[model samples]
Target: MNDDGRRTTRMRDRAAGAAVMEQVVRLHAQAPPRSTLARALGARPIGEDTAPWFAGALGEREVGAVLDRLPEGWSVFHAIPVGTRPDASGAVSDVDHIVVGPAGVFVVNTKHHRGQRVWVGERAVLVAGQKQPYLRNSDLEASRVRGVLAQAGIAAPVTGVVALVGTKEVTVRQQPRRVLVLRAEQLVRWLTRRPAVLDAATIADVARLFDDPATWRPVDSSADTVERFAVIEREVRTAQLVRAGWMLAVALGAVAVALPVVSVLTR
Candidate 1:
């Protein structure tokens, strides 16, 4: 029970990455065990099925880390499950983050495309020249959040934001019709700069409403989830380092061979 005498589930800081991390855990569990040789060679432990989810988890974590730095008077919720049932992808639809501040409410959708170029238009988002439904998804999430707030008798405006993570560059041809597109690093600054629309009392009310687990869908989460993901993340990073070392060794060997050949030819 919280101070308001309402029962609530314990929330973690990494709630933003919970959904994707759950997906990674499930997919990793289903994949066949790797052989000793494969493990030693640093072959990807996460299969193709789990890689995307892992990447997404990392993206959400990055965004969450930044959101954590928000000054006082701002309230943030991560991974708010909005869907009553899992979609065809076997994943529940969730808002990556919900932020309520003096500026009003924001529905954040996190997209992680490492080292990829992102172009945002008035109604479209292109990642590596391929169209993504980021804008549409952001709008939908905002709408859902609005509905939830309305049910609670809170009539604050909800803004949609698409936060791009790990992108090589983010180019906005034009802001989306109903959404703000920004790189993850720009999110906090953009948010803090927004003019205040809600006062102290309203902000506190909305924050309490969001803090109640009864306000969102029923989902199971615990500290264990974060710990489990941390283990997997460490393994993945170790494998990556091993692979890089092997590549470096191979490149040096090739250079060494080429140097000897050049010496003989010159002599």
Candidate 2:
């Protein structure tokens, strides 16, 4: 609702992982039966179906946290539902994060490759020696954002960014022609350093357009989505801690037995 008493749907301000979080929640609900014994032994309760989305949700949250610290004059929107997928299934695709500031608009694609090596070349991205289509995908995402703004009678420069999270190494052989690649931790600094490209009024106008839900595809989100995810995340973390404790106990017990045997043999 608005001051005009007209119905309205404003985009969620803190929708960093809303898309992936929905996938995680849905897949978790549909996961096949798991062994109760394995769960008791501290195995992760989430099956393979939901594991990737869970990780993705965490990655977006991390990147969102970094973006949240952006200085004044910058605005960011996350998990923006965009155009439909090319597969013709009518499935909507989403942009991980959209940032509007004095510098320019940025369409950020977040890749969460925890502890993996990432190498970016002029035309390709390799994660742990496996080639990925991140470069091509980012370019298309930026183009879509530009089209959306143009439709709103706004002309702006939109840049594509691939924000890698928790990677062991990010070696850029060469910068991509269309997209910027960097570690998530460096995103805010890089963005802020760019020269001012839009004035305050223009920035506000662009942000207002972005804030309107009609600018993007429709998304189904609940107010309690973040809360539900927090519950699941806590469960996963507790299981990991329990597993680590058991491993430590086993190692210590083996060492304790080995010490007496070693002492007897030495005597």
Candidate 3:
């Protein structure tokens, strides 16, 4: 997915959809409608020229739905912008998902493709006639996420996960190491599974950080791209109120004591 798509995916976390998501919702409502649009923006639609784009939307919706089901406390972060790292050609990568918590940091790659055959092996996800090197990329992503967290002064283990969305047929030959494969329905369980390495305190800390929108990032997860404007409108009017209430009381006490002393001196 492109950058705009990633932003739409994160918007879903707010239980709110952007213009593109609204368009998709409208498309869903209208049947006998432009089936072509569905092909272009939904899950894999056969013979659809923009199946890739539609599949991407489906992937974001699926992944977002799964992450949403987690209990209120579990912090789920998507499409984080890590600092940067060099690739084989010395190009730095901007990885996809970063789930940071006590269970550990997880790097996730969301794949939305439809086909009759699919297999996830040691280093590749084979779907129909093509293959995506998920293992290698996910490992690299995990390393990058770890490095980013380290820069934040937090030491934690990192894992990789692949979230697949699409109505396409899928079959796996073997489970890949350090990677959790999941569909939309199984997201919470997949995420909340006992960690192999991270301690509990660190996990809670990671979750806490994600709940704050201050550090949240916006990125595209769907194929349909859009111009981005990162504006957050908050209603909270936080100020130094009750925290200074004690000081006000202290000043009043001083005035009360000084008044009596001054009256006696003047008289």
Candidate 4:
């Protein structure tokens, strides 16, 4: 194949790959686009809660972009499906990113919690004062990657990486033994500094295994997209209704309290 053909093939392969979670994409698509003028005014669209989705997608893309830029030896896979096929509802489990290079194989789990303090422990993680299973979850993801590689006849060390994006502060109370946590910006430096673990031949072989669509399981495309959008729409509407219900309850309580005061005053 010529250069153009290779480029076209890469593009087609990327299109076929399910790198981002369907739910995340659906939530982002469900949100109305805000104009440049609105953004300048610091205004966001009302009624749709896209904050969580946007942050998550942004972090994934940010790290993916960085991985994409790695010098010649690196190969990065985004939105990899693992363990199961898409269910009846078209929902499938996904891993964020997997990086293979001379440095090693890393199962990179991204956490996009901008402006929120994150606390990490040996076996636990806490974000904004709420406990989360981030460390444990990352470990599981890495193990899954290891399992997949093993099935493909590749015996390689798979490292668990947790990349924190746009965090206000991160405190490591007890360093996790199973996962390496780093700020997204610090990722390139950290990876590049690692001792060479895989040779060019090994990198090429591993990359081929990961690049094959069959390695990831059942493919989910157009049909899954529609179902995911429907799910997100329902979630948004339900949230709006719940907010409205709380507002109604507050108004009724205020009326009840004011009625007693008015009666007392009239007397």
Candidate 5:
């Protein structure tokens, strides 16, 4: 086929991807709380409410600071999805913040943990006191974003950085590897030091890359993945409630059985 036909195909693919992704998002949103998960383990909820926030309040604040200093024409993409499929991985890595500046696309992961000693690796972030599985989550996100933009016919460099936000007690134990790990204060200064490789023209062109925000969505094939998981969750809850009611009924029966015995003994 001609150029237009190829472009149309890509557009349709992206749209379908986006639609399926939305369904995945909804299922995740309806997920059980950590407290509920804890209860499954015979534990209580440690915190007040269970809605999860990876960045939390302070992470959001510091990111805002970094965004405030960016060049005027630069566009900031907050919580942009980059998965080839829907349903982002992990609690926090899914919606990375991307700042499209004149130089390149900057993919940022904001960490909001305080009093944590962080060891930044080439592809992993060690948080609090434990090392997690290594993966260049930010880089992968940047790559996916580039792919999306490429389909729109724009080629540009994408860079990944992790910004530590609200970490007043954070200490870096080692030098950063391929990734640039810094606090929000440092990130602003670093971004301002150099002009972007992609200026106004390039940023604009890349922005228009794909017009399909719908189509092969997050919920397509992935819908079952989330739905099955949800069914499992609901079943667990139902089982718990059923078990609790049974126990209550048994307790009432015991009370009834003992009542006459107790009255006769007393008389």
Candidate 6:
């Protein structure tokens, strides 16, 4: 999502294959399809190898779609850049999404871990069996945004959120000290149900501050799409391999069980 209130457009683009799709499209447009060039660039058969990236992009999009459904008073910003400027490399680092409205300002961090169990503690989070700093990172993101807005004379309360997308189970062992963890579907409900703490005028004011590039740092719009694509490709490949390994393990366990059963039946 670009910083110009084009969340829906961005989401639509991402869901339609995004950068990888763009690469493929460009290659096809060539006089003779540049199969070699595309392959060299890590474009595979485009099934499992690319599913993860598309899935993740779609996850953010799903949340964005939900945000789109909010009432007129709400202002949703997707792909927000917070804290520092596009780093030493001149690329924009993004906060997944943000919602500003009567309820207050919410820093929405979307996680796309399909079928994994999520455990939330007062200070940490665990996805499947791996420790993730989702809450801590989200808290820092929210704080950074708060600081930026405060300087603009808008001191609206900013809350951090970790919205799990397609997760199998979510257990809140204890509420995190700073961030609220919930499923993506529940996100909109929770936000809409919050007690109103800001008025329409203040919400509009806060939205204006975020819309200004000065609130964030120098934004490097160039090459951001390419960089994002590269990252997505890597994640897709990794997710494919992980799923393959899990399938292999499950198949081997099934074979092992069947072996003993077959032996007993023969006797």
TM-score of each: 0.94, 0.92, 0.54, 0.68, 0.54, 0.66
Runs of candidate 4 exceeding 4 Å displacement: 1-21, 24-50, 83-90, 221-267
Per residue, candidate 1 scores C-alpha lDDT tens digits across 136-223 of 8899999998998899998798999999899998888999879999999998899999999999999988888887777887676555
For candidate 5, write residues 4-104 as lDDT tens digits.
33222233122211222333344445665555655554332212222123224336445755676776766664544344542243322344466666767
Q: Each prediction's Cα lDDT score?
A: 0.87, 0.87, 0.53, 0.72, 0.55, 0.70
Clashing pairs in 4: 19-78, 19-79
Off by over 4 Å in 3: 1-51, 83-96, 195-200, 208-267
Candidate 5 Cα deviation (angstroms), residue 260: 55
Two-way lDDT contest, 4 vs 6, winner: 4
Model 5 misplaced stretches (Cα beyond 4 Å): 1-58, 84-93, 121-124, 133-135, 169-177, 210-267
User: What lDDT does candidate 4 reach at residue 64?
Assistant: 76
- Who wins the TM-score comparison? 1
lDDT of 3: 0.53
Worst 10 residues of 5 by lDDT: 12-21
> What would the TM-score be for candidate 5 when compared with the true structure?
0.54
Error (Å) of candidate 6 at residue 111 is 0.5
Root mean square deviation (Cα) for candidate 4? 9.5
Per-residue lDDT of candidate 2, residues 46-164 (tens digit): 98767888999999999999999999899999988886553332235889999999999999999999999999999999999999999999999999989988988987899999999
Model 1 residue runs over 4 Å out of place are 1-14
Per-residue lDDT of model 3, residues 1-267, tens digit only: 443443333322442123223333333334244255443333222223222333554565567666667664456665454434444433224344555544667666777665445676655677785787877777777776666567567777778887776636666667787676655456568667755466667777666554443343433343432222110001001112332554688799999999999999999
Give residue 15's error in model 3 in angstroms.
8.0
